[model samples]
Target: MTTPANRWRDTPDRYGLISRLLHWLTAAQVILLFGVLLAWKGFGEHPVTLLLARIGPHGSLGAMLLVTTLLRAIWAYRQRHHRPPRPPGVGGLLARSVHLAFYTLLILIPALAILRQYGRGGHLIFYGMELLPEAEREIAWMMAPADLLHSPLAWLLLALIAGHVAMALAHRLWLKDGILARMLGSPQATRDT
Candidate 1:
């Protein structure tokens, strides 16, 4: 049986509760953010899209995502030595590179957005809380990086996420590997793998 302590911390065979929680939470936020964007693009100014926009404004969702990603990164670093091992050889190298990129983009995307928002001299409201008051003048340099790269980088991040999901599914269905189980299954299920 999985002990209480083991459930909250990473093991060599499976992810701990905290890790799983953060992972899934982050995934949910990403999906919601993307869904809103896609809906806006596809449906234009439909009532449903307008409602979604109000409920989950782009800035608010991005702020939440940024916080979650940062927390996940910190937890992952702490659990680095205890988490499940990566695949051997070339697969491991590729996995490592992809993960590094994932972390980089996850942090960068929202960070750039926040920077841009501030540069525009607009008040920053996160979940009804005012985080930044409006400035007297816009800072062009502060906004430049995000204005130039935000959309392009966002598209690239989407592509990376797609590849990540495909690989996970491939591992579970085609390779019959326990990789998916490591994160999705109970500790007992992964211990034997």
Candidate 2:
């Protein structure tokens, strides 16, 4: 019953409009964050990097990402019983595992970073909104997890994303399945008959 115009809700064969938007929006944010991090690491604080950092720092963006991931998780859970069936056998299991990891890291990485931010005894102002008030002193316990895991976990997330993309492309181009089209192509074009 899902037509092109009514693609706002998910069908068994394809993701709905809202889900697609959220997925792409999250992807864009992740790419932007990666770019900023790479620039900061490579250039070591040039004026341009500083300006970019001030304009779109990791903490604020991470907060945004955290919110997006939470909303996406809720949406996915609500639609869980309505979506297309996973492929059977090992492919299905692998797909499920990758999705689980992605969701876990998406929520945890920024959460840990945010904890670390507040633990450093500094106020966090995200796009002019005050998220955390300044602390009196650095809290070692609060900061430790992020200091140890945030960057490494983020890199792992990036690797998973790479694999995800590769698998999507393989599904579309090599396997000749419509997996990528379910998310990216016209819903009508990929609709189950």
Please provide, for model 2 over 62-164, each residue's C-alpha lDDT reduced to its tens digit, 9 standing for 90 to 100. 9999999999999999888867667899999999999989999999999998899889998887888898899999999999999999999999999999999
Backbone clash count, each prediction separately: 0, 0
The lDDT values for all models are 0.88, 0.86
Off by over 4 Å in 2: 3-6, 185-193
Once model 2 is optimally superposed onto the true structure by TM-score, how far is the C-alpha of residue 57 displaced, in angstroms? Answer: 1.5
The Cα error of candidate 1 at residue 93, in Å, is 0.9
The window of 10 residues in a row where model 2 has the poorest summed lDDT is 184-193
TM-score of each: 0.95, 0.91
Model 1, span 54-157: residue lDDT tens: 88889999999999999999999999998988889999999999999988988999999999999999988998999989878999998999999989999998
